[model samples]
Target chain A: MRRMSWFNATSLTLGFVFLYLPMLILVIFSFNASKLVTIWAGFSTKWYGELMRNEAFLDAAWVTAKVAVASSTLATVLGTMAALVLVRAGRFPGRTLFSGMIYAPLVMPEVITGLSLLLLFIGIGLDRGVLTIVLAHTTFSMCYVSVVVSSRLVTFDDSLEEAALDLGCSRLEAFLLVTLPIIAPAVISGWLLAFTLSLDDLVIASFTAGPSATTLPIKVFSAVRLGVSPEINALSTIMITIVAVGVITASLVSKRAAVKRRNEEQAAGRA
Target chain B: MRKFALIALPYTWLVLLFFVPFLIVLKISLSDLALARPPYAPQLDLSAGWQGIKDFFGGLDFENFIWLTTDDLYWKAYLSSLKIAVISTLLTLMVGYPMAYGMAKAPEEWRPAMMMLVILPFSTSFLIRVYSWMGILSTEGYLNQFLLGLGLISEPLMILNTPVAVYIGIVYTYLPFMILPIYAALDKLDGSLLEAAEDLGCSRFTAFWLVTFPLSRSGMIAGCFLVFIPALGEFVIPSLLGGSETLMIGKVLYEEFFNNRDWPVASAVAVVLLLILIIPIVLFQRNQQKEREAGQ
Candidate 1:
């Protein structure tokens, strides 16, 4: 076995510390009794309690949840379709352009995407509100979902679908029963990812949001810009906790599924 | 029929929602600004049908683009954005390379957890993460306080409200993008190749230099572009962290659109930014195509 090099050890420790230090600091300071973010006077849950009492924060969070749910669901459906077309559909007309369009949004600057979509909304005389935000988020987030689903699709065994067809199931039926079930995990993960993205996005939402459709990120951004109070830190800590719990739960579920699959395969081999 | 339905649904949605918007932006970019409800001249009248379309095109001009060229602020913003993006990309790579390498070298069982750890911060609210940096890097923040306590500094270092803070904020935010791709590249590397080099009397460092670094070039490039492209258009980090000195094009575009209400000018800026981004966009597409072909 290769020994752990000093360089590797130092890099791992330092890298993790660098990545987590700001977040840890934010979390610890969220409970500080002082209004000032820098000084740690004493620990208290007042800020968290105050955050709970903030009506604007509560409203933004509700808007964020609505947008995340709507957009992620929309993105998953559309993205799954796009992924299927890319992976399973034979070369169709405008295949190259279609692929480009699918992937272009992945790296397109948020400002540009936001700006362009805003312009589109204005040009089409559509109202800029939660609907526009959902549309924008869905459009961009679906591209990411398509990428994830497409990678999984590329590795999928087409023979299974072919066999299902041979066994008298129609293509749609087979896909619904077999392919969809198998790719459900990827689709779910994609939805989760899209949800997180929609939730985290401030720039896009800022451009597309109407007077009454403020998202949590936009709200947080405005408050943070004004000043970094413990209230914002308290909000951040809560947001971090939610994300951490979600990710950890997702990871554990996937891990357990993998182990179960392995055990089933082992039993089948023994039989 | 099923296939047609599947294809038509998303394809139509993207075309209407994603592709056509760029055309609208292009159209707006060519129009002159006006003090109207929508704030641009030559508004397309769909009610007039074909004649309205012709009239719209007829009224469009390159006035906004011309105005963009005359302004030094736009040029400076573009230049500063490029400079900062390049520097930040390099910094992210330098920091991320080691972290990625270390993660890839970690035991197999720990790899997933390590990756999850790297990605956990990324999943958290991006605005919050940037806000967290302010608490650490401000003059009276944690960094200054710690350094003072350790007697490492005489005065509170002017870290915040500078480009240094921007760099730090960027590196912190984009670090995962840099790390994930490089770790993937390193993880896929065969151990036997390194062992073969070791048996041939090469040291670990030399072997890594010759074998690992060269192999990881694509991942590095991928990571760099991921960081660089977004960093170029980054508005939040510079505004909140870099103070007034940071003149990224994204901020400029934001100001022109919202502050000045120059929708035409903002559209022009977005058009030019897209044009500037075309090179990397093409490069990235080519890389993806090559990867797909390689997979095949």
Candidate 2:
């Protein structure tokens, strides 16, 4: 057991407080009856009720949800394929460049990605709307998904697929029956990550989204840019809650999967 | 055929969406802005065949690049962004390193949860996270209220819409980037190394400064790169948290495109930003390669 000194304890506590305090304040202030950040008015859920009544916020949210679902699904597919290419297709031609492209967007500025893609849409004469937004989201978020899935792929045993092949399983069949089942957790988590990215993205979505098709972040941005409002706080509180739950669930799912995989391996070895 | 299909699918997707778009940015950056619907000159009219390609190349110039250089705003924004990204990265390191060290020193069973605690912010909307601070940093915000209530200051300090707010936002948002890398390094350090140093007649602090810190250099470097590179071109944090004086290339590029509708100039700005980024990105890649080699 590593010793937790006074310094370490204080650092951890203070660090976490710094991290969580603002969000906690936002969430708590969301229920305030008055539209003040500091003043504690009586607790009421009126802001949330107002949020429900707001048609524009609701419509933007609906559009965001639709974009998230479509883009994340598409990203998962392309990302998994890219991961397979990076991991399994060893020493292929242009492998370095391929991997470079895969990783580049991870650190690329949101502005550059957004600007370039918008230019592409205009250059190719593609209309800026939900479809353009989906394409842009898929392009960037796929890099993230590939990173997640490829990390899992690295630790995966190559012999397991070989065992399936030795039993006369076709390559495709072996992949579907053996490889896919084991890596499903990573892929699922990848999808979740992509989904969250799509939902949270502001800059990329803003550039790609048409004036008529504003996403929640763009709407929230315009609203918050003026000043803090209880309605914006309520929206943020809800988003923070959703994302926290989603991230936790994804992490837990992956952990559980690892344990389950170990148990199945142990059982098979004993047999 | 199957192998070909697997490679081609994603390769084509990236080439089209990623690489091709980048080339278009490069091309447009050279061309002059036009009042046309698509808003750039010398787009190839293929019906004109060989003559069109010649015209396209002929119309391209270094003027946009020159314009960016001549404008004090563009270069100043670039420099200010560099200054901001560098300072914030250092701040994040100072704030993050201790937390990471604490996590590494924690009891084994508690480490995972602590790590998750660090990552939980990522799941939240970034705009919301930055916006959360506005309420706290504003004159009537909680921080000021608390300070005034405690009799720390008679007047509320103007923190919102200032460079200080932008710094706080960057450090808050990018803390995880710095922490995770440093934590990974610290976690992998063999406790025996510190003990060995201590047995050689060194204090715990000296032992850490000499042995553990040197060992964790790679992680520290990686963490810095991760923080600095993204922070350099960050749009959302600066735009939301920054005052008009908080000049960043990302926000400038954004305004150039959306507000001014100067697509050529916008593309030129992006091209330059990418050029500036190539240095750190290349170093990051080399660092990653070295780490991988060391692992092997």
Candidate 3:
């Protein structure tokens, strides 16, 4: 059963290569000496230097960062509240509608979501800018956050909160002391998920952002639309590397936590 | 009281932001296009009272929807989008199945690392992932150079800015979605069932067909939906990777709103897109409902 058959091994290798080879190529070519992106003559660090000095890219990155941080924080709070309602509320009016609204945005097309949101902002005469981007990002990403946090909530031990209640605590106090600390990991992951989502968004940001405010993705899209340049390749490489490191580090940390918990539980049982 | 506050806050936010905006799109889809700043006509002016309400309803028409049917550009875009989505979803399934099967079939201790490897690319920005293909698929790109160097072809292939490139981009980016669900389904499958099938005089291939493949059906369906739904309304792939010859409803919708400044017609296009999506969305919901009920 543990035998590694050639059939499975070949497919896995080829499949991963197919999935990753393009990005690998893009990363390798980022250091190319040529102005034209595809043709590589020799190694150079000029594009990275150029990327640093490009004010437009820097400004866009700043806006994107601000939007991601603010929106993800707001989304985390709203989404945690939404998750509490979903997991704990019973037989409330509009329960079905509430759940429906939470799940619908996860599958809604970006174009549709963006367009609908834009019209809403315009209909009420809200100027499109950073504020609008934050609003739009918060609305959609909050759904993702709720989905993340709620999955953890469904498996949560209610007896701990009950124990807190039995100790003469109020409902809110019980929740803060018992429920939140237990679910903090999921909540933090939810925040990170929302953060990445906000950072990755281009279509929604484009619709909600005014001419005065541009995001990094919008800048990359417009630049790539003109044709691929070494600077963009350098930029893509940086983004990919950062995400790669972050994801790897996260998985390792979670893995170690799981292993430590299992070992401690075993030791406690043996003792 | 606190529970009510908890429920009401998100509820009100969704109602105002999500639900109301959808109704607005539906209303604008019915209204006429204007040269005004907001662009659509038949604005529902509450200030004018019952008279304004009556005039608004009277002025609203299905003219833009009728316009959608009359123009063949929108029709071609719809059909092409459907075609591309169907093909790409199939391609993604073909590429992702073996990988997911491999992950599920791997030895126990290696699974976590393998799973992380699969998900790592997905954490990167989607636009960057799609843009990665441009450097490889361009005529003078690495792919052509490699093929020509290998003597695989006499001349470089023109893959970029074509439907083929769109298929690649979609399949590449959405492969993780396809793999994850199917892997879940396969990982849950009992290995003993396959062993018993083989013990009952079935060959290895026969046992897999009889016992394993059928069990993975739910995951396959879910994975297909995950890829197909987003691919249908994808704008970035077509606009960036596809040539001018390529047409998709999402790209058209974007052009209508931003390039042409025709809000009513864009809303009409969106309405039709949603109508098309409703079928799959309903099916997906029903499938999930069935799975949930079955799980219980």
Candidate 4:
């Protein structure tokens, strides 16, 4: 038993090291004053300063932010509706095909999807640019958002909407007044997920994006191919910090919400 | 009325934008390559006319499909991609399972922290992570530096710009993918069953093999497919680390479409890849449906 515990602890520690040590090193070297990625001379914020000064990097970052916001917002709206239909609508002809179509992009190789879309755009006389990137991003992003929202919808009790309807409210009113409020959290979470996916995507973006429409991931990818740089590390560190903050905040908010609900139930019981 | 429109609108958008493009690719794949044009026009049977009443067999050729099978280059790349994907997936499973098991056994408070550690790296740019491997595996990079510092080697090993580098890059990027699903599965595992096994005469290894491993098979399968399929289609990692000598299908397809400007050939290559991937895709979807049904 003791031997088993030791083995488990060792293996787990090794696993953690495997997963993290490289990231830790990258973060550390981001602050290194040396230009060479391997040799760390001394700690400095000069690479970050260089990143701020570089107009190309800033432009790419701005493009990425815009794409994430635009694509994710559109995805959230479309996905919510798709989820509603999938979960609430009665049997309809071709429902299986619709479901398959919605989820197909999730598993289909991004390269194939990108290639197919690129071909379609050319066939339609559409140029490869930001518009193409946004359209492509929206395609897969909506699927993810729908999956998240529909999963949340599955747990929702139909009785709440039905009760509102029973009180002489129209179906639309009931949905707006009851169902919409209940699933609002799901919509927001789905949007966040969509945003992150859009921001992180590279392959599809590479295929769809024109020279003028370089997103941050594509920029970083090209830079990495040329050679590793401290500036890229600086950029990575900043991005990691942002994602970590978002995740931590989301967890805390959810935990707080759970506690508030529990306390309200207790108060109601006492009353 | 508004609700009906709301639901109908998105489905229409998906059909027009998503499904149409795929249909176009399928159509083009079946058509003969248009010679002497930048955008190769797909061969069409105008003899069928507007009504399109004709034999389905007469419309398209399986020449592209035949080419994919007979062509030595295509077969070689496909085989190499399969071999790499399988080996890397197996390595990921071996490494990930123990870590997931340990995470599952950790104190409740620690589980979230561990999960965060795993997912945090994922949230960062994948490009950077793959790039980071370059710095580590390069001839004069950290791994060589550390080894040289330790007097482990007289000269820096030539690890970069090889198939081994491609393998390392792939395995590094995909390890988290294998870890997360397995961890989720093990996290939801019932402790009582393991306790029962222990109470009975089962040893720890026997109990894990008989009880935990079988129970976590779904997660294992999910993780493997997720890693394997994507790894097979991977372009960036191999492009960056595999150097010029290594030839994977994704890179080949990219060169065909962009460099050589051969859309028909690229489409043919893609059709072949889709065929190879169809089995895993079906299996994954079926497993997901089963899970959903079981959940409900």
Candidate 5:
């Protein structure tokens, strides 16, 4: 209702700059020919070439991709189930416990989660490996997906499912055909979110991963700990570009779908 | 039968993976450190039946918890972690509130893009985001270099590896968490209500203070908890950006577990950290439950 105040404008400008300037600096330095990150050197793709030649980093990236794919898929299925139970099941037994377990991971610190999960694996005699890492990721990322999907489920129109059931569809078919299609966007976004989270996670993975299975973040973290180098910068820049592109595309698709859905709804209203 | 399946599968998974782990951590915290394979004493062998159970119970003690209290470093780390978390949450709220307000007030068409800008950084790797700060906060980093270039300072300020850098890292990383929730609340606010306040002879600023601020209180609390809880146990920011003098519970727990190879102490630290976090977390859960009820 009100125009953008000068205060709000200044705040937004400053806030965005604070958020993006470090990333901008990191990207710019990734192209530097000099070994040092801060120094200005002639433009070069040497670091990117070097990253390509580094086997460990490549291996780490491969491991990360596998973990992301496997974990996110499992998280999505489990999370979708959790969201449905939370939204549609009403006050089932242990409802509070179910909700608590679902939401706890969202705010639980990585150190605690990592430590606790590691202990669980150790206690259960499960070997620390790629499988353990996937399990850990799935546990935490499932919570995130539940949060995303549950929000969508809350706003969802249940009448459509009711309508489907009234039209002689079975309960299962009503959900599969009507509810699932409508909430597919939220589910998809939830999967992508879990994928990114699993990919990006370093702490939990570090704790659970065996000696043979280092993820990319762990690799970069140890290398960066040795000090800033242009090669790591190059690797980081690549990772940033991939993630940024993925997020932007997902948002654009979702936004377009939302607009189209609204238009159809308006047309139906008129008819 | 189908409803039972839907609830049973995920519920069993969480109980096995999520809930069981915490129980294990608690059990481990009570165990004595040993030079054994699992690095703890009196292991619980369920296959051995009653004898193994008795051995496990016999070995359990409060020695690690006692040791935690005896160590000044552990207590100091916990205090400093809480201090940093509280201050950073406040800072994020201050920075995020105006930005969220702006986004909520912006043209409807631009809102999605604005929301995307906020979510993009979040979807990126957390470690890289912190790493980017290292390049900007180091003594020879970008910020100091820029200031030096502009003649604003005679020397490169030692911003990196300092507590201030940790603050910056926390605020930068958690700003989106603060903003998004607040924006959600503000966006849902009735424009007519603000107009009503103004029509009753209130200034626009007072209208916001009285009407908008109170309505957005839930979001602010939610945002603060979201930022504060994880930040308290944050390991990366403190380890990478903070100076040696900087102490946080997460770093200390890490050192105890890995460097010192002391699982019992680390578990004890974790238990304490969780105990401290319980209050805010329960409050957050209550708020979420209330919101869910309101929505339904």
Candidate 6:
């Protein structure tokens, strides 16, 4: 038993190291004083300073932020509506096709999707640019949001909506007043998922984006082709920290809600 | 009746935008290469008429398909891509499985923290993660510098701009993808079964092999397919780390489409790539259905 426990601990520690050692090294070397990329002469904040002042990176960052926000918002709305429809409506003639179409982008290679969309846009004479990027991003991102929202919706009790309708509320009013509030958490999570996906996208963005429509991923990819710099490291570290904080906060809040619900049920049972 | 339209709206949008585009690609892939003109026109020539129809039906050429199969370059690219993808998927599994198993067995409080660590990397730009590798693995990069500083080597190891670099890039980029699904699977694994095996006087190794391994196979398979399929078709990492020497199908397709201006050949390659990807996807779907049926 002691031997087994030791083995388990060793395996776990090794896993943690494998997952994080590269990232830890990345964060450490971001502050490396040398510009040669390999030599760690000492620590410095010069890279972060350089990143702040880099005009092209700054512009790309701005573009990425806008695209993430806009596409995520669009995806959330469309996806939430789609999820509500899929979950609430009875089995229809095209239900399988609808579900398959929604999830198809999830598995399709990004290159194929990007190329096909690029072809479509060109065929229609719509120049590739920010609009096309957003459109492409939204197309895939909506699938993710729909999957998340639909899974959440599956656990939802239909009686809540039925109860509201019974209490003289119209279907729309019942959805807004009851169903919407219940699924708000799923919607928020779906939105965040969409935002992260849009921010992280590269391949699809590469195909759809024009010269003036570079995102942060595109900017970094182009820059690395020339040669890597510590400035890129600095940018990555900041982005990782922000995402880590968001995920941690969201998980904690959700866990607490679960705990609260369990406690409430226990109390009601005792009463 | 009104709600029907509301539901129909989103489905219609997806069919028109998403499904139609794929159908367009399929149509283009089937059309003659000669008919491909600027502004994206796929013309059907009836001059050859019945012979062309017979050729199409009989699979006389499949011109593009035949080109892809007969060409040495295409076959080499496909083989290289398969080799890289398989090796990387195995490496990811070897590294990721132990970690996911460990996380699954950890204290509940620590599980969330550990899972966060895995997922946190994904939130950042994937291109940056790949770029970060360039800094670490390059001859003048930190790894060589650190090793050289320690007198571990007389000369910097030539690691970058090779197939090894491509492997490193794919593993690093897709590690989280492998971890998340496996972690989820392991987390949901019933501990009582392991306890039962131990109670039955089974050794720890036997217990895990008998109980945990089988249970986690789905996640393992899912993770492997996820990593392997993308790695096979990946263009970016190969383009970046592969330098000039590496021949990857994704890069080949990219050149065909963008550089060579051979849209028909590009379409052919895409079709073949899609066919390759579909095999794993079908197997995955079958496994999922079996699991669902067993659950019911």
TM-score of each: 0.96, 0.97, 0.98, 0.93, 0.94, 0.91
Candidate 1 per-residue lDDT over residues A130-216, each given as its tens digit: 999999999999999999999899889889888899999998899998899888889999999999999999999999999978999
Q: Pick the candidate with the highest lDDT.
A: 3
lDDT, candidates in the order shown: 0.91, 0.92, 0.92, 0.84, 0.90, 0.82
Instruction: Show model 1 residue runs off by greater than 4 Å.
Output: B46-52, B288-296
Interface RMSD of 1: 1.1
Which sections of candidate 3 miss by over 4 Å? A263-271
Give Cα distance to truth, residue B230, candidate 6, Å: 2.5
Question: Tens digit of lDDT per residue, candidate 3, span A1-271?
Answer: 5797899999999988887888888888899998977777899999999999999999999999999999999999999999989998988989999999999999899999999999999999998899999999999999999999999999998999999999999999998988998898899899999999999999999999999899999999999997788999899999998898888888778778878889998999999
lDDT score for residue A15 of model 4: 82
Supply candidate 2's per-residue lDDT for A156: 97
Per-residue lDDT tens digits for candidate 1, residues B1-296, read 77788889899889988899988889888988888988889988889999999998999988888888898999999999999999999999999999999998888788888999999999898888888899888899999999999999989998888989999999999999999989988988999999999999999889999999998888898899888988998999998998887788999999898999998899999999989998887786677577568657
DockQ of each model against the real complex?
0.81, 0.82, 0.82, 0.61, 0.71, 0.53
Candidate 4 lDDT score at position A188: 88
Q: Compared with the true structure, what per-residue lDDT tens digits does model 3 show for residues B154-268?
A: 9999999999999999999999999999999999898889989988999989988888889898889989999999999999999899978899999999999999999999999
In model 5, the Cα lDDT at residue A242 comes to 95
lDDT of 5 by residue, B239-283 (tens): 888968899999999888889999999999999999999999989
Return whichever of 3 and 6 wins on DockQ: 3
Candidate 1 chain A: worst 10 consecutive residues by lDDT?
Answer: A1-10
B260: Cα error in model 4, Å: 1.2
TM-score of 5: 0.94
Angstrom error at residue A79, model 6: 1.2
Best-to-worst DockQ order = 3, 2, 1, 5, 4, 6
Error of 4 at A96 (Å): 1.4
